[model samples]
Structures are given as structure tokens and as C-alpha cells.
Target chain A: GEEVAQTPKHLVRGEGQKAKLYCAPIKGHSYVFWYQQVLKNEFKFLISFQNENVFDETGMPKERFSAKCLPNSPCSLEIQATKLEDSAVYFCASSPPHFVAKNIQYFGAGTRLSVL
Target chain B: SQQGEEDPQALSIQEGENATMNCSYKTSINNLQWYRQNSGRGLVHLILIRSNEREKHSGRLRVTLDTSKKSSSLLITASRAADTASYFCATDISGNTPLVFGKGTRLSVIA
Candidate 1:
């Protein structure tokens, strides 16, 4: 069984400030994904990383959101100049290289972002 | 946008009963997955059925896929009070766009 862990269960930030969330994938997993759940409803794709390289960022808001999966440190998704609409629960999920389709996915509890 | 849409936005059932949720997608997929989210928490992957497969099972959970219909369904038998949660279907649309999820079915299982 694999586990994906996210930090800072809740966050509060001003509208113009920056928000950064962290995720730690399982010990051997290679792919890390970030998704935003607005008001605990629809999940909006953000970005995904395969190891240290970003594989797909089409869903990410290039101007405001960015993510990094550096070695040693846990993966991170940062939003610069956060807005009111950015208030949502950001989930971090990880899957093994070949398991994205069939292998069981592991998700962290999530980080609730509140932009005032 | 190849989003998975779920049927019966909400459902209510009693304990020891079976809970079934259906999901329909817009396009072809490499595989379709079902996930469970408890309240405000993140999603927990329940099962993943490949495109070529018709049915899959894990414990009391059952998942069936129909490529022609572009649909899937998840069945949980002997439901319990703790099974009350939002069940969602996420489709792996054979690309790098990440998994697209449905609106989910809010299930309330009464004891």
C-alpha cells in the first residue's frame, strides 16, 4: 500500500498574497499530481509531475500557479497572487509509474486554502 | 472536455443494502476509475477497470465497464453506516491531462 501525504491541513491568505502547498508521495512512486476541489465539488486539474520533470501542465494557470518536485524535499504547488476564487481544497495524489490507469492511487488528506 | 458525469446526484439507502452509482464519459478512455471522498478530505481510489476489461472486483466493491456505452458503474454490497460518503468516478482519458472526475454521488447510508 502507498500513501500520499499533504501538509498544512488548512491555510488562510490574503487575496494578493502567495500560497504554497506541499505533498510527499509514497517512497517509490514516480508520478505526483495536483488537483483543486472547489467547494468540495468538482475537481479541477492543475498540474502533474513525473519524478522531477513536469509531464503535463495544460490545466495549470501558467500566470499564477506553479509546481515543483525537487529531490529530497516534498513536492510543492505554489500560487502567486492568489485570488478569491482560488479558495478551495487542494488535493495531492501520487501513483506508481504504470499504475495511473490500474494501480491503486493514494491521496493525501488535502489542504484547505482560504483567500480573503 | 471528456468529463465524467455521474447519475443520481444524490442517493439514500439503508444498512446491509447495496449502493450502486453510474458514470458516463464523453470520449474514449484507456481506463476508468472510481474514487471515494469522505466529506472534505481528498479522494481515495477504490478501483480501476481497464478499457478491455468488463468487470473488476475488490473485496465487496464491484466495477463494470462498457466501452461501447462509454460508461461505468460501481457497486458496493452490504453497505454500512460508515459507507456514507461522496463517490466519484474519474476517467483516465489516455493523455497527460490528468484524471477528469465527475460531480460525484452523495450517498447517505442510514443505520
Candidate 2:
């Protein structure tokens, strides 16, 4: 298995529709992070999880975005009422737990979501 | 504001030449990392420099960190066409904090 796996390499949805993205972290890695990149620009941190528990989510856009990671299941980020502005490539990354958290993330091939 | 900002948004060089990229940050950090992303691909981790380490070398890659200056630089020796890609610098500011990435520097190596 790959270090990190993201489902649906490309997703297309109409405005106001829902978009769901899934990620499978590497085995033995407990930390997961999600990022959004638009138009080849900088990566924007969206959320992170530590072993199925939400660790930090300050960057999440609250109105229409949510995410979850359950034990034995792939972590998922769901966006409701997708807007044209929401179009971007979503990336998933994972890292092993360390005492000092000098985390070196392993990223998955992103899922490019296009909102029409 | 972005925590890490990379200078020279893009660079072009001939094969076998050296390529160097610099990054600056605005805050204290636990560590800094460099990653490479090919077109339409996931980022590939290149190197990680801790706050206490000044320099590290792996193969043809050399990385230097200046904690006092809140900056870092990555130098790749003998650049190859295969090395062409976008390079990004990410900062780990604190424990359990998400990495803040810079707008990448696009490197184009001419064969």
C-alpha cells in the first residue's frame, strides 16, 4: 500500500452540490492533515487529525465544510453547497507521531475538484 | 500573512548547473522542511532542518538553516532535467500545529 492514498483523482460537481473526498493514511502513522491549493498557489491548511481525533481546525471554512476520521476507516472531508470559488485541488498528508512533533509529512496525490 | 515566503517565484537553469532557493519566515519554528512537486503530482519531501542544526547534506542536496534569521536555503548540485519542479518551504511553528507553506518556486531545468 502507498504511504497516503486519496480517492477520486478528479471530481466534478455543479454549484450547490456536495463534494466528498477520502484519504487513507500510512500504516503506523497517526497524524493526518488536509490542505487546499488553488491555481498553483500556496497550500492552505484546512484541518488535521490525530488518530481519528480532531487536533486542529482553525483554517476550516465553517459554513460549508466538515471532516471526520474514524477508527478503521479512511478520513473524509466533505464540502456542502459547492461554490465556484470552492474549486481547488485538495491534498491529504500523514506523519508519524513524535514526542517533539518535528513532523515530516507524506502527501498523497491530490483530488482535483471542479465546481461548475 | 504567510508564515513562510520563498523568494524568486521561478528560476531557469541549464542542466548540470546548481540551483539554490531561499525561504524566510516571520515566527519561531520547531523545524523547517522542503518539498518538491512535479506537475499534477503530490509533494515529495526533500529535507528537514531542525532549529538547532545549521547545515545538513544528503547526496547532492545541501540545506542550511539560520534560526536567528528565521530563514533557510536549499541548494541542489548538478541539477538535472528530471529535477525540474516546484519547490516549497514549509514551517512547523509549534507542537500539534499545522505546517504553513510558502508559494512554491518553480524551477525549470533546460536539458
- Return the top candidate by TM-score: 2
Q: Could you report the DockQ of all the candidates, in the order they appear?
A: 0.61, 0.75
Cα-based lDDT for every prediction: 0.88, 0.92
lDDT of 2 by residue, A13-99 (tens): 999999999999998888999999988868999999999899999989989999999999999999999999999999999988877
Misplaced by over 4 Å in model 2 are: none
Tens-digit lDDT string for candidate 2 (B55-108): 999888999999989989999999999999999999986655688999989999
CAPRI-style class, candidate 2: medium
Q: What is the lDDT of residue B108 in candidate 1?
A: 96
Name the lDDT value of residue A26 in candidate 1. Answer: 90
RMSD after CA superposition, every candidate: 1.9, 1.3
| Model 2 C-alpha lDDT versus the unseen true structure | 0.92
Error of 1 at B72 (Å): 0.9
